[model samples]
Target chain A: MWDGILTGLTTAVMPFNLLMVVVGCFAGTFIGMLPGLGPISAVALMIPITYGLDPASGIILMAGVYYGAVFGGSTSSILINAPGCASTVVTAFDGYPMAQQNKAGKALALAAYSSFTGGTIGAIILLFAAPALASVSLSFQSGDYFALMLLGLTAVAAFSGKGQVIKALLMTVFGLMIATVGTDITSGTTRFTFGSVDLIDGVSFLLLAMATFALTEVVMTVMRGQHNEQEPEMDMAALGSMKLSREEVKEVAPTIGRSSVFGFIVGVLPGAGATIASFLAYGLERNLASAKEKLKFGKGALRGLAAPESANNAASTGSFVPLLTLGIPGSGTTAIMLGALIAYGIQPGPRLFMDNPDVFWSVIISMYIGNLVLLILNLPLIPYISRLLAIPRPILIPLILFFSITGVYLVSFNTFDIQMMVLITVIAIFLKLLEFPMAPMLLGFILGGIMEKNLGRALTMTDGSFSFLWDRPLTLTITLIAVFVLLFPLLSAMIGKARTRGAEVAVNEGEG
Target chain B: MSITKDHIGGLVFLCLSVAYGYYAGQIPLLPGDEYEPFNAQSLPSALAIIGGVLSIALLVTADRSVEGRLKLAGYDFWLVAKLLLLVSLFAMALPWMGFTLSTILFLVGGYWLLGVRSIKTLLVASVPFAVVLWFLLSQLLDIYLAPGRFFTLMLGV
Candidate 1:
């Protein structure tokens, strides 16, 4: 283990590798600052570039981008009301208020430190834990894979909520169906290609993700227009000099430690990404803080501001564990990374770590470097980024649209992809109008293909017995866990609603 | 706004999935002696069945639910339609107009639709960004770009 750590550290110290980390962090920061363009998009745009590099170098660069983007997102959320993406929404609860209260620099500094701390700790845990988990997974058969996919799917309920649970389930099933389009791996049958030569290979999830998440986002931005109002320039000089007093640090220390653990566990679960983790952490923090302290949550309470920022950064690192060791991508960005690995002729599975330890460990080590880079950059750059709000909404929308369109087209140079983008964007708009969660849609798209492949393999191996799913203890346990997760929201909602029956109904009717 | 539209979309997707399952049935499978008996068509067909069942379920529930009856407002439809039109246009023009020109036009149209009325703000904000992207995507990264005929002809490289 020490040798592996030393190997990882040594690999990351190479001049070229260090340069890639710097570049990745710089690009990640810019991409995260832009609304609707998350770490996923940044990674997607960079995937093609990585095609030419060594596998270890490519993976490290992408990891840098992922960690760097989370750092960048916190700055925008703190300096302005804009969150850049869902993960930072909790940050905005206190971050924007900090800006308003004239402590933008201090808030930014604290956010940088907390994020660095959370992220580094998360990376260390991932480095130590992933290998042990991967070794256990080496014994996994088709049954285990099938059960794991089921576990991933059941996370929809835990993540999406009761009102939209059914829709999220159906959407996931639809994604699985869509995954069947193209030549089958075992049978070599042409499935849903629809006679289009382009689709014989199947719809690229990268293309689909870009269309669904990025392009659709552009359309929404256009519809919503710019909502941010320019504020007085945050005094850049005073920000750097401001320091966290010992008492103030004492108050937030517990919050940070609790949120870090919370975020790490949340990230361990499939489909539960940084956004949900951060939101859950903030909610927990709110419940724990004193009433006198609680009132300060939205008004720039240091703990409130720090909790989500730390949790989300930790969550981002945590999300990578399953993707690297299990070959199961927990989020859209990791899905794209998996695609990148596949394109390089590397299968991301339990064997991947044993087969290519340098690639796996180097990427892990690079994350440590990425977090440090983000901390250094964000601390001094908050005021510079805050000034960007002065750019009118009218002008910013067009530039955003341009990037969205150009980025997608450049991916495959396919015109048909653009048409698909339009179709998906339309569906996204309707989904948003109804307040449906987009994360589930993303999770569905990412996991859809893998679930189908494993399920197919499992059924074939079992010779038609549905009992195979129940035969294994580990598999059965996972399925039971999934069942419990699916039913959790319904059970909680019913009990909560029952208690407030009369008053809740009155309020509901009044709102309607 | 019509519950009918949602139901119709579901129905259409279901039928299409069934057709896809039939197509998957025709794809060649690996020889039975090598591994498992079930081949390519089985998984897809299973998914199709699940999709079909859920779609029907959604249609039925939507038919009964009053909330599904709400129609999209006029402005919503217009916004969606315009977005579709612009995306299709950008996709088609990309190979011909090049990334920069197509990006500029799309941005202008998008900003206008989104309520950015100032021409000056649009140009000033969009141009520099487009040039920077061109440099990053095309030059620094060495990504193969589909240059416009005009640019290619003018450069004569």
Candidate 2:
């Protein structure tokens, strides 16, 4: 482990890789500040650029972007009430109120400091947690892997918000259906080409990600007539002192610490990402607060701003745990990273720690450096970064659209790919209107091929029987867990219905 | 019953699953391959079944509130349709006009569609950005971006 850490340190400190981290942070910050684009879209936009680099540098750049986007999202949430992503929505509950109170500068500073501490704590935990988890996962067999993947898919659907579980599951199935479009590797036969040559290779991950996230998100903004809306005018002069008083610091200290740890645990859960963590952290802090403090939560209490700011950043780092260890993405952003790593011909899993120690360790090391860059560099430049948001929406919209389209086009240089992107973007827009979750579909798509491969191997070993699922105790445990996760939401919903019916019946009896 | 977004979504997916299952059956298997545990048709068949079941479950338990209905009003669907058409046109133009020219045209068209009518704003935004991007790909990266078919036919170079 020490040797691997040293190896990672060497690779991370290399001048070019360091440069990539800085550039990725800046780019991610800019993109993430834009309304309607989140870390997923920001990272997706970087895919074409990363393809030109080595796997280690590519992943390092992406890691920088991931947290940078999260940080940037907080910035937008504070300055304007328009959150750049869902995770930062909780930030706006108090952050915007602080901005309104002419303490925008102080709010921004507190956010950056909390985020820095949260991210550093997360990275420290990841340092110990990742390798240990990776070593344990090394024992995973084909049956175990199949079970793990099943758990991943089910957890994503179950965690999808109220009334969306069935929708999420159907979307997952849709993603799996899309995954079967190309040639079957085992048999070398085309399944859904419909006689088109472009369909022969199946859909490219880059195209799907770019289309679903980058292009569709930008187009959604235009569809809502946001393109015509005036750019937010920042009152730079009104931003007050950026420093936190000693009392303020002491007040938020425990809140930050608790939220950071809480956020990390939530983030490590597959499919529960920064968005949920930040909301939960804020709620937990509010619940724990005394009456007077609780009253100040929505009105810009220092602890109110601090809790979510720390949590989301910590959760961003924590999401990488499952991605780096079990090869299962903990969120939509990590799911895109999983796809990128696969594109690089590097399968990220337990083997990744041993097979590509530099890629593994360097990414971990760069994450710490990336957080430092956000604090030391990006925090001070928040005012200037917010100015980039002033670019006319009409002009900026086209440029982003151009990038999302050209990003995919440059890879294959295939005109058909561009057409395919438009088609997928249309489908994505339709799905978004129905309020279906996009992340689970993406996660399902990413894990589909691997899950199928593992299932096939396990089945063959068990002579066409499904008994391999239960033959190994480890596999059985994982399978049972998947079943429970899948059924938990349904069971809870049923119980709630029954309770409501009983209440209504008792009320009627009393009235009679 | 009045239809909601969930009802439409469920119906669409149910039809999709049925079609997918039909195609899964059409996937040809190698000789004696069916005897094996898994084949090309295995996952697809299972997915279709699961998809259909989930779609039915969604329809059965869908939210019936008025808020659940799909609202199309107030959306700029016309502008969105035009923008999508422009994207399709850009793809069609790529082989004919090449990367740089097509990019410039796309940006100009996008700006125009989004209500940027100033010729200077349009030109300034599109031209330099397109040329710089093209130069970065072709010169700095040494990528061979083809001159358009139109240029090839006309210039014979």
TM-score of each: 0.85, 0.99
For model 2, how does the per-residue alpha-carbon lDDT over B97-140 read when each residue is reduced to its tens digit? 89899999999999999999999999999999999999999999
Worst 10 residues of 2 chain A by lDDT: A229-238
TM-score of 2: 0.99
TM-score of chain A of each: 0.89, 0.98
Best by DockQ: 2
Q: List the residue pairs that clash in candidate 2.
A: none
- lDDT at A488 for candidate 1? 83
Clashing pairs in 1: A187-B28, A187-B29, A189-B27, B1-B70, B1-B71, B1-B72
Q: Write the per-residue lDDT of candidate 1 for residues A168-237, one digit (tens) a residue.
A: 6667766676676676665565766768888888777666666666666656655553333344455666
Q: Which digits, one per residue and each the tens of the lDDT, describe model 2 over residues A125-162?
A: 99999999999999999999999999989999988988
Sliding window of 10 residues with minimal summed lDDT for model 1 chain A = A224-233
Docking class of 1: acceptable
In candidate 1, chain A reaches a TM of 0.89
Error of 1 at A107 (Å): 1.9
Tens-place lDDT per residue, model 1, B1-157, is 3554456546655785677667656656656723564656666667667767766765665543556554555334566577669778877777778878977787777667666777886786667767887898779988877787667778864
lDDT of 1 at A187: 56
